[model samples]
Target: MNTKIEKLEHILTAFYQEKQIPAHLSAATVYSLMAGGKRIRPLLFLELLEGFDVELTPTHYLVAASLEMIHTGSLIHDDLPAMDNDDYRRGKLTNHKQFDEATAILAGDSLFFDPFYVLSNADLPVEKLVKLIQELSFASGSFGMVAGQVLDMDGEGETLSLAQIEQIHRLKTGRLLTFPFVASGIIADKSEIDLEKLREAGEAVGLAFQIRDDILDVTASFEEIGKTPGKDILEEKSTYVALLGLDGAKNQLTEKLSVAKKLLTELGITDRSDIFKMIKQLEVK
Candidate 1:
């Protein structure tokens, strides 16, 4: 069986190249959309799907890609002049810089709104469909990812507690991370207990992912990271590494990932051995 990442990349790249949007708009959209990253959110959803005795359908990738669309759109918006205002992402110039600010803005807007149509039109079970929308919606809404972005930007000029930083990461990053895991159970017809466990595991891994990211912002080079380093400190933002210190951050990352793996193993998912490895890899890099 294909590991979640391989299966997901094939699905996404195929879908991405197959479509033809309008020349101008499609050009802008595909440019940022195809801009590379780990595609982690969608892979998490697929890994959860693998836990069930089901076939990998084209419908699944469509749902997964929608998650990426939101993620990419958020990144585009996040890099705007009013936001992070960075010049690099995925080791390339940011969308706004590459295509011009207005084009980047519209591309981001297209990414944001286009996924709803795909999800609403997907072939998933109705129960699964509704929950998918609910999951993604929560991850994108004011109380979720956007809320985190809002706090992050708004917090820079103010004094915030460690609790506030966690709250920011939870909403901005953890919300989407948790969605794929939790929503997969709903799609796979898993029990409520399993659902809760998957959600918890997802949250743990997601939180760890952000902490690792915080550490990377300081330690990683631009060549390795694909983005400008020291932006967090430069921006004066609070992060796990800042709050916990390097050793403390690593410890928390290890603890959360261990808990996440525990839940995944307990759920009887053997196919996700790579997923476990991937989580472990996040701590060191």
Candidate 2:
């Protein structure tokens, strides 16, 4: 897993060096791109491809880079004053704070559009390339992450039901999380049945991630989480911890993770310890 993530970082670094953009815009974009992150989404994609016994190529790394690009763009926008209004992310000043609001917006915009360029350049067949583009677009755009962001903002300061909160996360967080599995299936040419199972496992992981985040927000410190803690409570946002209580939320997270691991077992993956290692990282400290 570390090897795969290191390869992804190398690919991303080479991409920014090779591509040309406006002077300040490129700097702002690269600032956040190079900002250290867990790179979970792309790592999940690459690891799933390996689980399917697919031989990875430079093209696969390109797709993983694209996924990271989209995820980073979302974080940039999410930290804007009008959005989460965050000052720090990944333990550094956010893009809007590091640069400026306008520059951050443009930087995010460029990252969002740049993925399509990277995906188009991947060595996959035209059909697979189109599917990859369509899946990414759907996951990152209004119907997916944007929709969740909108709902999350709207639900702020309101008492939301469990179902409402789940819906928001499934759109905002789950879609992108789910993309890696579906994309891996497309690249590996898996059957529709297996693809659906992978999608389920991905969704489970996504929800588990959010739940762990909610728990961490309440329980962790600035040094622990690398960002402001208690933001959810500060914003009066509905969370698993809010509705389910810390213990209940932890139980829910455990259940979701168990479901994901079980799905992988059902898929007949041998030596899934690497993916399991990734899943284990999501657990609360």
Candidate 3:
């Protein structure tokens, strides 16, 4: 895992250096890219590829990095004054705070848009590359994360049912999480039936992650979460904790993880221990 992470870091570092980016934009983009994160999405993609017995390559790393860029861009926008209005992220000044609001927006835009350019240049077949782009756009665009964000904002300060909260997360968080599995399946040339199972497993993992996050937001401190804690409570947003209480939410997390492990078993993935380790680490305490 450390080796894979180091490879990803090297790839991201070289991206800007190789490209013809303007000085300031490059700084802002690289700052957010290098910002500390768990790199969950990309790591899952890479690990899943390994599980599928596909040898790692620079192309795979670029695909993973592209996904990471989208995730980082979303975070930058999420911390904007119009959104969560956060000042810190991963123990560093939020993009808007580190560089002004306009620069932050442009930085996020760069992260979001440049991934396609990166993907286009990857050493892959045209059909596969097009399919990857299509899936990613569906996940990150209006049908997925963006729609989820809109629902989240609209539901703020309003009572929401558990099902509603789940719907929001399944799109917002679950879609991106599921993308790793689907993308991995595509790269591995797995059957459609297997791909569907991976998607389901990924969604379960996604929900488990969000539930743990809800728990941490209530229990963790600034240093612990590396972001503004209790933002959900502050914004009167719906969350698993708000709807389920601590015990109930933990129970849900456990159930979701069990489901994920079960699905992985059904998928017959050979090298799944890494993903299992990641799932275990999502535990709240």
lDDT of 2 by residue, 64-132 (tens): 999999899999999999999999998999999999999999989988998899889999999999988
Model 3 scores a TM of 0.97
Give lDDT tens digits, candidate 1, residues 1-285: 245556555644554454575566667767777677788888777766766655668788778888988998899999999889999889888989888899889888988888887788779778789888988998888879899998888888566787898888889999988988887788788899999999899889879889888888888899888999999888888777887888888888888899998998898876733566667677763
Models, CA RMSD each: 2.3, 1.3, 1.2
Q: Where is model 1 poorest over a 10-residue stretch in terms of lDDT?
A: 10-19
How many residue-pair clashes does candidate 3 contain?
Answer: 0
TM-score each candidate: 0.92, 0.97, 0.97
| Model 3 C-alpha lDDT per residue in residues 1-285, reported as the tens digit of each score | 888888998877788776678888888888988888888999999888888888989999999999999999999999999998999999999999999999999989988998998888889998889989998899998999889989999999999999999999988888888889899999999899998999899899988888888999999999998988989998999899999999999999999999998988787777643877887888764
Q: Stretches of candidate 1 above 4 Å error? A: 1-20
Candidate 2 wrongly placed segments (more than 4 Å): none
- Give the Å error, residue 113, model 2: 0.5
Model 1's lDDT to the true fold? 0.81
Q: lDDT of each model, Cα atoms only?
A: 0.81, 0.89, 0.89
Residue 42 lDDT in candidate 1 = 84
